[model samples]
Target: MCSRLRWTISSDSLRGLLLACLLATCGDVVAADPAAVGAIAVVVRNDSSIRLMTRDEVYAMFVLDRRGDFHPLDLPESDPTRAAFYMRLAQKNLTMMRALRSKLVFTGAGRPPQQLDMPALIGRLAADHTAVAYLPASDLPAGTRSVAVLQPSP
Candidate 1:
Protein backbone atom coordinates (compact mmCIF):
# COMPACT_ATOMS: atom_id res chain seq x y z
CA MET A 1 0.00 0.00 0.00
CA CYS A 2 2.85 2.38 0.70
CA SER A 3 4.43 1.57 -2.63
CA ARG A 4 1.10 2.09 -4.34
CA LEU A 5 0.71 5.50 -2.77
CA ARG A 6 4.24 6.49 -3.68
CA TRP A 7 3.70 5.40 -7.23
CA THR A 8 0.48 7.35 -7.40
CA ILE A 9 2.25 10.41 -6.10
CA SER A 10 5.10 10.00 -8.53
CA SER A 11 2.90 9.51 -11.56
CA ASP A 12 0.55 12.27 -10.53
CA SER A 13 3.42 14.66 -9.99
CA LEU A 14 4.97 13.76 -13.32
CA ARG A 15 1.70 14.07 -15.17
CA GLY A 16 0.85 17.29 -13.46
CA LEU A 17 4.24 18.74 -14.20
CA LEU A 18 3.88 17.78 -17.80
CA LEU A 19 0.46 19.33 -17.96
CA ALA A 20 1.64 22.51 -16.33
CA CYS A 21 4.53 22.78 -18.68
CA LEU A 22 2.27 22.15 -21.64
CA LEU A 23 -0.25 24.71 -20.52
CA ALA A 24 2.47 27.30 -20.07
CA THR A 25 3.82 26.69 -23.59
CA CYS A 26 1.20 25.07 -25.82
CA GLY A 27 -2.55 25.26 -25.47
CA ASP A 28 -3.00 21.70 -24.14
CA VAL A 29 -1.22 18.60 -22.90
CA VAL A 30 -2.55 16.33 -25.65
CA ALA A 31 0.68 16.56 -27.60
CA ALA A 32 1.74 13.92 -25.12
CA ASP A 33 -1.12 11.78 -23.94
CA PRO A 34 -0.45 9.53 -20.98
CA ALA A 35 -3.47 7.41 -21.83
CA ALA A 36 -1.52 6.24 -24.86
CA VAL A 37 0.62 4.20 -22.51
CA GLY A 38 -1.21 0.99 -21.85
CA ALA A 39 -1.18 -2.63 -22.89
CA ILE A 40 -2.30 -3.20 -26.42
CA ALA A 41 -3.33 -6.64 -27.67
CA VAL A 42 -1.03 -8.70 -29.77
CA VAL A 43 -3.23 -10.01 -32.58
CA VAL A 44 -2.66 -12.66 -35.19
CA ARG A 45 -3.74 -12.73 -38.76
CA ASN A 46 -7.08 -14.49 -39.18
CA ASP A 47 -6.03 -17.15 -41.58
CA SER A 48 -8.36 -20.13 -41.85
CA SER A 49 -5.23 -22.22 -42.22
CA ILE A 50 -4.31 -21.39 -38.65
CA ARG A 51 -6.32 -22.50 -35.67
CA LEU A 52 -8.39 -19.98 -33.79
CA MET A 53 -7.33 -19.31 -30.21
CA THR A 54 -8.81 -18.17 -26.92
CA ARG A 55 -7.20 -15.77 -24.43
CA ASP A 56 -5.93 -18.74 -22.53
CA GLU A 57 -4.09 -19.94 -25.60
CA VAL A 58 -2.61 -16.53 -26.23
CA TYR A 59 -1.43 -16.11 -22.65
CA ALA A 60 -0.15 -19.66 -22.61
CA MET A 61 1.84 -18.94 -25.72
CA PHE A 62 4.00 -16.58 -23.66
CA VAL A 63 3.92 -17.82 -20.03
CA LEU A 64 7.29 -19.61 -20.17
CA ASP A 65 7.08 -21.88 -17.11
CA ARG A 66 3.64 -23.33 -17.79
CA ARG A 67 3.74 -27.09 -18.21
CA GLY A 68 3.35 -28.25 -21.81
CA ASP A 69 3.04 -24.65 -22.88
CA PHE A 70 6.26 -23.81 -24.65
CA HIS A 71 6.15 -20.75 -26.83
CA PRO A 72 4.85 -21.78 -30.23
CA LEU A 73 6.69 -18.93 -31.88
CA ASP A 74 10.44 -19.03 -32.41
CA LEU A 75 11.52 -16.32 -29.99
CA PRO A 76 15.12 -15.27 -29.56
CA GLU A 77 16.83 -16.40 -26.42
CA SER A 78 17.76 -12.80 -25.62
CA ASP A 79 14.49 -11.02 -26.17
CA PRO A 80 14.67 -7.83 -24.07
CA THR A 81 10.93 -7.65 -23.55
CA ARG A 82 10.42 -11.17 -22.17
CA ALA A 83 10.35 -10.37 -18.48
CA ALA A 84 8.93 -6.85 -18.75
CA PHE A 85 6.14 -8.05 -21.00
CA TYR A 86 5.20 -10.50 -18.32
CA MET A 87 5.29 -7.79 -15.70
CA ARG A 88 3.34 -5.15 -17.65
CA LEU A 89 0.73 -7.49 -19.06
CA ALA A 90 0.78 -10.22 -16.47
CA GLN A 91 1.52 -7.79 -13.65
CA LYS A 92 -0.29 -4.80 -15.20
CA ASN A 93 2.25 -2.02 -14.82
CA LEU A 94 2.31 -0.31 -18.19
CA THR A 95 5.52 1.61 -17.48
CA MET A 96 7.56 -1.56 -17.10
CA MET A 97 7.11 -2.95 -20.60
CA ARG A 98 10.07 -1.17 -22.16
CA ALA A 99 12.24 -1.82 -19.14
CA LEU A 100 11.47 -5.52 -19.41
CA ARG A 101 12.47 -5.52 -23.04
CA SER A 102 15.72 -3.77 -22.22
CA LYS A 103 16.54 -6.33 -19.57
CA LEU A 104 15.76 -9.28 -21.84
CA VAL A 105 17.81 -8.02 -24.74
CA PHE A 106 20.69 -7.03 -22.48
CA THR A 107 20.73 -10.51 -21.01
CA GLY A 108 20.48 -12.06 -24.48
CA ALA A 109 17.26 -13.93 -23.69
CA GLY A 110 15.07 -12.45 -26.47
CA ARG A 111 14.44 -9.53 -28.78
CA PRO A 112 11.69 -6.94 -28.58
CA PRO A 113 8.35 -7.44 -30.35
CA GLN A 114 8.66 -6.91 -34.06
CA GLN A 115 7.68 -3.29 -34.34
CA LEU A 116 4.58 -3.48 -36.49
CA ASP A 117 2.72 -0.22 -36.31
CA MET A 118 -1.06 -0.39 -35.89
CA PRO A 119 -1.82 -0.48 -39.61
CA ALA A 120 0.76 -3.13 -40.34
CA LEU A 121 -0.25 -5.33 -37.45
CA ILE A 122 -3.92 -5.11 -38.42
CA GLY A 123 -3.25 -5.74 -42.09
CA ARG A 124 -1.17 -8.76 -41.22
CA LEU A 125 -3.87 -9.98 -38.84
CA ALA A 126 -6.46 -9.69 -41.59
CA ALA A 127 -4.39 -11.53 -44.16
CA ASP A 128 -2.33 -14.02 -42.20
CA HIS A 129 -4.94 -14.96 -39.60
CA THR A 130 -2.18 -16.65 -37.64
CA ALA A 131 -0.19 -13.68 -36.46
CA VAL A 132 -0.53 -12.22 -32.99
CA ALA A 133 0.17 -8.65 -31.92
CA TYR A 134 -0.73 -6.13 -29.20
CA LEU A 135 -3.00 -3.28 -30.27
CA PRO A 136 -5.52 -1.01 -28.60
CA ALA A 137 -9.09 -1.03 -29.91
CA SER A 138 -9.14 2.71 -30.44
CA ASP A 139 -6.08 2.28 -32.64
CA LEU A 140 -7.19 -0.93 -34.35
CA PRO A 141 -5.89 -1.84 -37.74
CA ALA A 142 -8.13 -2.32 -40.76
CA GLY A 143 -9.84 -5.52 -41.90
CA THR A 144 -9.24 -7.40 -38.67
CA ARG A 145 -11.94 -8.78 -36.41
CA SER A 146 -11.30 -8.38 -32.71
CA VAL A 147 -11.98 -11.70 -31.02
CA ALA A 148 -11.26 -10.17 -27.65
CA VAL A 149 -9.77 -7.02 -26.29
CA LEU A 150 -6.85 -7.29 -23.90
CA GLN A 151 -7.96 -6.13 -20.47
CA PRO A 152 -5.94 -5.61 -17.30
CA SER A 153 -6.07 -8.95 -15.52
CA PRO A 154 -7.74 -8.66 -12.15
Candidate 2:
Protein backbone atom coordinates (compact mmCIF):
# COMPACT_ATOMS: atom_id res chain seq x y z
CA MET A 1 0.00 0.00 0.00
CA CYS A 2 1.01 3.56 -0.69
CA SER A 3 0.24 6.58 1.52
CA ARG A 4 0.31 10.35 0.79
CA LEU A 5 0.13 13.43 2.96
CA ARG A 6 -1.49 16.77 2.09
CA TRP A 7 -0.60 20.26 3.38
CA THR A 8 -2.53 23.49 3.39
CA ILE A 9 -1.48 27.11 4.02
CA SER A 10 -3.49 29.76 5.91
CA SER A 11 -4.41 32.97 4.10
CA ASP A 12 -1.72 34.92 5.95
CA SER A 13 0.93 32.32 5.08
CA LEU A 14 -0.21 32.24 1.45
CA ARG A 15 0.03 36.01 1.22
CA GLY A 16 3.49 36.00 2.77
CA LEU A 17 4.69 33.35 0.34
CA LEU A 18 3.30 35.30 -2.60
CA LEU A 19 4.95 38.48 -1.38
CA ALA A 20 8.29 36.74 -1.01
CA CYS A 21 8.03 35.34 -4.55
CA LEU A 22 7.15 38.77 -5.94
CA LEU A 23 10.05 40.43 -4.22
CA ALA A 24 12.47 37.73 -5.34
CA THR A 25 11.36 38.09 -8.95
CA CYS A 26 11.40 41.87 -8.91
CA GLY A 27 14.80 42.09 -7.32
CA ASP A 28 17.74 42.62 -9.67
CA VAL A 29 15.65 43.93 -12.52
CA VAL A 30 18.66 45.43 -14.25
CA ALA A 31 18.92 44.39 -17.88
CA ALA A 32 21.41 41.60 -18.48
CA ASP A 33 22.33 42.80 -21.96
CA PRO A 34 24.71 45.76 -21.95
CA ALA A 35 24.24 46.32 -25.64
CA ALA A 36 20.50 46.32 -25.30
CA VAL A 37 20.64 48.81 -22.40
CA GLY A 38 23.38 50.96 -23.98
CA ALA A 39 25.99 52.98 -22.17
CA ILE A 40 24.85 55.74 -19.81
CA ALA A 41 26.01 59.32 -20.17
CA VAL A 42 26.34 61.89 -17.44
CA VAL A 43 25.12 65.01 -19.15
CA VAL A 44 24.66 68.75 -18.72
CA ARG A 45 23.36 71.55 -20.84
CA ASN A 46 25.52 72.24 -23.87
CA ASP A 47 26.38 75.76 -22.76
CA SER A 48 27.01 74.93 -19.11
CA SER A 49 30.24 76.15 -17.55
CA ILE A 50 30.87 72.70 -16.13
CA ARG A 51 32.44 70.81 -19.01
CA LEU A 52 33.39 67.41 -17.69
CA MET A 53 32.90 65.28 -14.60
CA THR A 54 34.87 62.42 -13.12
CA ARG A 55 33.17 59.12 -12.32
CA ASP A 56 33.44 59.79 -8.62
CA GLU A 57 31.96 63.25 -9.05
CA VAL A 58 29.10 61.88 -11.08
CA TYR A 59 28.38 59.19 -8.48
CA ALA A 60 28.52 61.74 -5.66
CA MET A 61 26.19 64.12 -7.46
CA PHE A 62 23.57 61.43 -8.02
CA VAL A 63 23.72 60.28 -4.40
CA LEU A 64 23.10 63.81 -3.08
CA ASP A 65 26.66 64.44 -1.94
CA ARG A 66 26.22 68.23 -1.95
CA ARG A 67 28.70 68.75 -4.73
CA GLY A 68 29.12 71.88 -6.85
CA ASP A 69 26.46 74.22 -8.19
CA PHE A 70 24.85 71.49 -10.27
CA HIS A 71 21.32 70.17 -9.71
CA PRO A 72 21.18 66.44 -10.36
CA LEU A 73 18.04 65.35 -12.15
CA ASP A 74 16.78 61.80 -11.96
CA LEU A 75 14.73 59.76 -14.39
CA PRO A 76 11.53 58.18 -13.10
CA GLU A 77 11.93 55.26 -10.69
CA SER A 78 10.46 52.77 -13.18
CA ASP A 79 12.63 53.83 -16.10
CA PRO A 80 15.08 51.19 -17.30
CA THR A 81 17.72 53.84 -17.95
CA ARG A 82 17.52 54.82 -14.30
CA ALA A 83 18.19 51.23 -13.26
CA ALA A 84 21.14 50.93 -15.64
CA PHE A 85 22.55 54.25 -14.47
CA TYR A 86 22.60 53.27 -10.82
CA MET A 87 23.66 49.68 -11.40
CA ARG A 88 26.43 50.40 -13.88
CA LEU A 89 27.82 53.75 -12.79
CA ALA A 90 27.05 54.11 -9.11
CA GLN A 91 27.44 50.38 -8.37
CA LYS A 92 24.12 50.41 -6.51
CA ASN A 93 20.73 48.81 -6.96
CA LEU A 94 17.44 50.68 -6.64
CA THR A 95 16.63 49.22 -3.23
CA MET A 96 19.90 50.40 -1.69
CA MET A 97 19.57 53.82 -3.28
CA ARG A 98 16.02 54.19 -2.01
CA ALA A 99 17.02 53.12 1.50
CA LEU A 100 19.94 55.54 1.59
CA ARG A 101 17.79 58.41 0.40
CA SER A 102 15.13 57.54 2.98
CA LYS A 103 17.68 57.56 5.79
CA LEU A 104 19.09 60.87 4.60
CA VAL A 105 15.65 62.43 4.45
CA PHE A 106 14.75 61.08 7.89
CA THR A 107 17.90 62.51 9.42
CA GLY A 108 17.47 65.86 7.64
CA ALA A 109 20.74 65.29 5.86
CA GLY A 110 19.73 65.34 2.18
CA ARG A 111 17.02 64.45 -0.27
CA PRO A 112 17.10 62.50 -3.50
CA PRO A 113 17.12 64.35 -6.81
CA GLN A 114 13.83 65.29 -8.35
CA GLN A 115 12.54 62.49 -10.57
CA LEU A 116 11.24 63.51 -13.98
CA ASP A 117 10.13 62.03 -17.25
CA MET A 118 12.37 62.29 -20.30
CA PRO A 119 10.72 65.33 -21.80
CA ALA A 120 10.53 67.20 -18.50
CA LEU A 121 14.09 66.23 -17.66
CA ILE A 122 15.26 67.47 -21.04
CA GLY A 123 13.32 70.69 -20.59
CA ARG A 124 14.82 71.21 -17.17
CA LEU A 125 18.33 70.76 -18.53
CA ALA A 126 17.57 73.16 -21.33
CA ALA A 127 16.15 75.79 -19.00
CA ASP A 128 18.48 75.29 -16.04
CA HIS A 129 22.11 75.19 -17.04
CA THR A 130 22.97 73.89 -13.59
CA ALA A 131 20.96 70.74 -14.16
CA VAL A 132 22.77 67.44 -14.75
CA ALA A 133 21.35 64.02 -15.54
CA TYR A 134 22.02 60.62 -17.06
CA LEU A 135 20.37 58.80 -19.91
CA PRO A 136 21.11 56.20 -22.52
CA ALA A 137 23.80 57.55 -24.83
CA SER A 138 21.62 57.14 -27.88
CA ASP A 139 18.74 59.07 -26.32
CA LEU A 140 20.74 62.19 -25.41
CA PRO A 141 19.06 65.34 -26.62
CA ALA A 142 20.68 68.05 -28.73
CA GLY A 143 20.36 70.57 -25.89
CA THR A 144 22.52 68.37 -23.66
CA ARG A 145 26.01 67.02 -23.99
CA SER A 146 27.65 64.15 -22.22
CA VAL A 147 30.09 65.04 -19.49
CA ALA A 148 31.09 61.45 -19.03
CA VAL A 149 30.27 58.16 -20.73
CA LEU A 150 30.06 55.33 -18.22
CA GLN A 151 30.34 51.87 -19.71
CA PRO A 152 29.01 48.80 -17.98
CA SER A 153 31.43 46.67 -16.03
CA PRO A 154 32.62 43.45 -17.64
The C-alpha TM-scores of every prediction are: 0.43, 0.74
Task: Please identify model 1 stretches exceeding 4 Å from their true place.
Answer: 1-42, 48-88, 92-95, 138-143, 152-154
Per-residue alpha-carbon lDDT of model 2 for 1-154, expressed as tens digits?
A: 2356655331122445767687866754554543357788988898998888888888778876575777888886667788778878667777988787778667877667867789999999899999988888888888889999988665
RMSD values for the candidates in order, in angstroms, are 14.1, 14.5
Q: What value does the lDDT take at residue 76 in candidate 1?
A: 22
lDDT value, residue 119 of candidate 1:
49
Full-model lDDT for every candidate: 0.44, 0.77
Among these predictions, the greatest TM-score belongs to 2
Question: Residue 144 in candidate 1 has what lDDT?
Answer: 51
For model 1, give the 10-residue run with minimal summed lDDT: 69-78
The local distance difference test score of model 1 is: 0.44
Instruction: Give the lDDT of residue 47 in candidate 1.
Output: 42
Residue 39 in model 2: shift from native, Å? 0.7
